[model samples]
Target: MKGIIFSEFLNLVEDTFGLEICQKMLDENQSDGVYTSVGTYDHRDLVKLIVTLSQLTGVDAEELQRVYGKSIFIRLYQSMPGLQGQAHSTFEFVKSVEEYIHIEVKKLYQNANPPKFTFVSEKKAQLIMDYHSARCMSHVCFGLLQGCADHFNEQMDIDMQPLDDDGTEVRFTLNII
Candidate 1:
């Protein structure tokens, strides 16, 4: 995981909850609470933060991750100016993740271990995204898809299923509405 993700997650917590709660979370967490956008940290730290927040808020980790992902997309849109003015539809943008966004990310951080995403199907009304990651952040991916739809003001019907029972490999089907 990257420090920017931790910073963003904390930011979302603070904005949705309060600074007091956010500060308390950081204090309770084993992490030192110092995060630099370009810095990388253990993925377990992020999982801990989310789990703690879930315990505090009585929100499931999956739901929290989904919301976090959806909101984070807004920040991504603002930070990546190259994507802001582009006219690609939401589905188009989602389809470009592995080829465009992840490629750029790897260029900046050669050691970054990004998830592998393959667009199994690209059609006028539907898309099939195959997500494979050791980190197992499919809930976040769902949120990202929702955020993309929201960003483009497009209504989408999305269905997610794990290829295996463990959920390490998942498939996402997006049908534009």
Candidate 2:
């Protein structure tokens, strides 16, 4: 996983749960909680942090991932000047995730293992995307989708369907509300 993710997650934890909890979670984890945006780390580190945060906060792990996704979206959008004005709508932005955003990510981090998103269908008010990632963190994708809708000031309804037992594949249907 990317270190920016860990950094942002820790920031979110600190913002939401206070510094003490964030520090405590970090102390419990194997990592030292120091992450550089350009560095790469084990995906398990993030999983461990999420698990620890959930236990400390009494929140579901998936829910925390979703919230983190939403929280990070704005930072990502603002930081990526190249893609800033390229997308004006939620559908437009979501469509660009695989081709544009991930491509930019690959340019920045050659070893980054970003997830794959395939559009199953496209419509004026809806989109169906097939998500595949070995890490199987679709809830984060769902949160990003919601964050996109929120960013565009558009209302949306999203549905997720699991295609495998391991959550490596998921189908997401998003419709403008």
Candidate 3:
């Protein structure tokens, strides 16, 4: 496996399972340094990293398999919506290469007491709307339609509407609930 492929697989895992899981995997794989190293890591390293971390973390191997399998299907769908083809899925091949590193964050503070975790209030929808409105203007001016729409929808959960049939500039109003 190549470095690019490994990075992509990590991204897919992060997108599907969330950053915490991927971050933990990186930590466990001593290869955490690979992230900083100038392109020394590759896809084979990534596969090994995930598998070793999964084993250490007690996250079922089967669960990781299901997630990776589904990701492959989604990628295929996006790349070739109507076309069908048979290919050897590199899904697992990418999961088998890195050595796991397991650093317990709490141990870092064993001498000093760990701080208590607390929940913070989430920003209101109206605030999110205001932020997007400002962002949308910048994106439109820069001709980044997809980026603008993605940010708008993510922050406000509202689809952008084209200002005209030209499909150049668009607008979205957040519905506060």
Top of the candidates by TM-score? 2
Q: Positional deviation of 177 in candidate 1, in angstroms?
A: 1.5
Winner of 1 and 2 under lDDT: 2
Q: Provide TM-scores for the models.
A: 0.94, 0.96, 0.33
Name the 10 consecutive residues with the lowest summed lDDT in model 1: 79-88
The lowest-lDDT stretch of 10 consecutive residues in candidate 3 is: 93-102
lDDT of each: 0.86, 0.90, 0.38
Instruction: Give the local distance difference test score of model 2.
Output: 0.90
* lDDT measured at residue 126 in model 2 versus the true structure, 0 to 100: 86
- Per-residue lDDT of candidate 3, residues 1-177 (tens digit): 223335555776678667887777777776553343223344446557657656756776545543453444344234333222232222111111011101222333233221121112224442111112211222221222222223223322333455555433344333333
lDDT sort, best first: 2, 1, 3
Q: Which candidate is the best by lDDT?
A: 2
In model 1, the runs with Cα more than 4 Å from the true position are none
lDDT of 2 by residue, 137-174 (tens): 89988898888899999999999999999999999999
